[model samples]
Target: MNARLLILLPASLITAPALAQGGDSPLDPLFTCRDIADDGARLACLDAAVDALRSETESGEVVAVDREQIEAAEEATYGLTIPQFRLPGLSLPGGGEDAELAELESASASPQRVIVRDTNGQIESIEGLAVAEISENRSGDTIVRLANGQVWRQTDDTYVQLTRSRADTDYTATISNGALGSHFMRLDNGGRRFRVERVE
Candidate 1:
């Protein structure tokens, strides 16, 4: 929200596509508001940028997502291992119970075993079918595209066992957190495991 960031918004938007492939983009709103000598002018510039983005979102030129959408994306991409989606309702590793999440129903060591039902709680295991597209990346990793329109990319460099897939066959992906914030993904019954990340 700083003035410097606001001034760079225009140029940053022009190069957004470059950021999609893991490249960095400076799309912060502060680009436009920066470099204004007067505090009032800088504030006005920031407000204008916010209003313009809001208008664009309303007009369908751009998408504006809320917390729920973010939660859904994390769920769809990485399973229930998201730390923020479910607040601190978990028991400490050594013992004593901490403050439970306001809406958390239960927390389990196995992410899939965990259950959260509050307004913001993580949903049950993400299970789906209809594997529409199954391809390998340049690194020889499987790229799965579900019929429901979710695209996942294999982050590890492991060759998939099956080269062909049937549309009617059911496929499931399990994602869990490793040490630190690292996330791992598994496909099918777990023959090939990869550090998968969501592409769409």
Candidate 2:
């Protein structure tokens, strides 16, 4: 840590209890050591803090997930409503990645599928997902299982003409967010569209 960082630490370090409640960083104590005037005492505080952090991490109390892992998790649980939790030291994308992300604002076709985003920068839709399986429930509602193991069931009464003649890449699906937290799944063949909710 440099002198400038030490000088700015106190203003940003929140209370430990508040940080725990928010699932925020557990490095508050380390930053608090910035207030120590004696060099030896400050070093001791930092060493203790680091040891405590390591112990917590080893015990699984504190998790450390990188940006790529988080992004992959986000993609996996894209349409599902899950609890929001963040690990400490998780950083936002850098300026270089930001420039690449800016280019993704518009949907572009490439070898890899492009994720479309809305004006607010939220993921608008995910396309080119192969339909792994299609089944109907007792109520005759359409249930779709994608290659990624995401299971979605039809919520509305709209009848979706989906066939299992050719599974996998033969039928592609696009899932996009709709108004009022709703999601719509559209199929490539016949452009069949239906409202769906992720069941698993």
Per-residue lDDT of model 2, residues 31-65, tens digit only: 89878999999999999999988886666555554
Model 1: CA > 4 A from native = 1-125, 128-130, 163-169
- Among residues 3 or more apart in sequence or in different chains, the pairs in candidate 2 whose N, CA or C atoms overlap within 3 Å are none
Worst 10 residues of 2 by lDDT: 5-14
State which candidate has the highest lDDT: 2
lDDT for each residue of candidate 1 in 1-200, tens digit (9 for 90 to 100): 43221111122232212112223222355575777789999999888878877775455444333343334334333432323222133222221123322212221212333323335343433433345567777877678765545466777666655524534235555545545545455556546666766665
TM-score of 2: 0.64
Per-model clash counts, in order, read 15, 0
| TM-score per candidate, chains pooled | 0.37, 0.64
The lDDT, on a scale of 0 to 1, for candidate 1 is: 0.45
| Whole-model alpha-carbon lDDT for candidate 2 | 0.61
